[model samples]
Target: MPNNRSAAEISECIRCGTCCKKGGPSLHHEDTVLIEKGLILSKYLFTIREGEMSYDNVTGQLIPASSDIIKIKGRKGSLTCVFFNEPESACTIYDKRPLECRILECWDTREIERVYAKTRLTRKHLVSTIAGLWDLIDDHQARCSYEKINRLLKMLGGDNKDDALKEILEMIQYDTQIREMTVQKGGLDPDIVDFLFGRPIKETIGMYGFKLKKQGDAYRLITIPTGQNL
Candidate 1:
């Protein structure tokens, strides 16, 4: 059943703050200028890399990301957009907000949905030109990719469990080491690691219902019982 309603019929934003509170909007190629112009700093953003599990706002469920989803970072200890001033019910960057934010009409989401996943901006698009930096990001993506991690998880409980565990642990170790080294030696902002590498592998692996525990300088993967992920 199709209900006909023009976008113009939808009421304008009332500053309810629901959209900003839900989470920050994913950045698209069109929004790159905002970052280039320094209107949005790197520390204010993070990336959900390709194949990573991410919450889909429209579907209200976690789905594997199809590509890098660069997004504004949330305030500390909350998922609310950092740019959102809750007390004032206004976006600090309202005038220069991303495409999604400008097109989104909570009452009529048709326009936002049409361009939601197109022309997504990834770390490569933003940082690929920098010497030495892009190399590290590319290597990290290749070695610690969720694609490889998912494949390894499937091999667990099979005869290849031992081999799978070794590889998974190694990837997690590399992910951690590189982040620390990049922050210490590369002089990058500590918070920017999430943007460059898309969250620590050790942490995101929990999306598979597994976690790592350090045991005398070594790590062990443990299966979290159902309903215990909270």
Candidate 2:
């Protein structure tokens, strides 16, 4: 890749919205001004929980990532950036966009990757008023962490397999119930539940070699090969 480009070279971008089409930019601590000004609402953000797997742009590899990252939520069922205006091929909040969006250059990724490496804005920084919610998150996470769930699966074998599976299912259900109840009692938006509790039970459990199959209002566990890497 070219190390440098002139203004004319950078002006090659046609505003086709292809980059934003891929996904929304993750917010940095510097972008808190936009959030505080209501340009970026809490409802518009979601958390990427610690230990969740994601593609690292800097490393160009899929890695078990850490950090409770706050990212702009994408449109439902789509990867497109929430601020992207499809008809105009422009950003809806271009004037007050996240730092990543402002510095991104399709021609050279050095700037964006540098910003990406910095500490991200977390829920604690954005919603400090709701310290209780953070406490609830910690409680739920300790009880139903991926490490605990994975360990439970690893212990499965022999005649105790059925009993172990039942325990895993119950743990998942219990975790789901806590998340739902948190939203109901804490007055948090239902849309942000996944952010608080990490991904859905099925997806999180899938990281530990289990898949959920829905059957007539019930879920069945199916063990798939995961290399037991977790």
Q: What C-alpha lDDT values do all the predictions have? A: 0.90, 0.76
lDDT of 2 by residue, 1-230 (tens): 23255555665566767679888888888999998898888777777766666657678876665776778888988989888988888899999989988888877788888788697887668665766877877877777766676567876865677887888888888878877797788777887786677667666666656788889988788877768632
What are the runs in model 1 whose C-alpha is more than 4 Å off? Answer: 1-10
Native RMSD of candidate 1 (Å):
4.5
Q: Candidate 2: minimum summed lDDT over ten consecutive residues — where?
A: 1-10
Best by lDDT: 1
- For candidate 1, the per-residue lDDT at 43 reads 92
Tens-digit lDDT track of model 1 for 1-230? 13245546658777778789889999998999999999999999999999999999888889999999999999987889999998788899999999999999898889988899889999989999998999999999999888899999999979999999999999998999999999899898998999999988888888889999889988899998998762
Tell me the deviation in Å of residue 168 in model 2.
Answer: 3.2
How many angstroms is residue 144 displaced in model 1 relative to the true structure, after the best TM-score fit?
0.7
- Candidate 2, superposed: residue stretches over 4 Å from native: 1-12, 156-167, 207-209, 215-218, 224-230
- Give candidates' CA RMSD values in order: 4.5, 4.8
Best by TM-score: 1
Q: Cα lDDT of model 2 overall?
A: 0.76
Question: Which TM-score value belongs to model 2?
Answer: 0.80
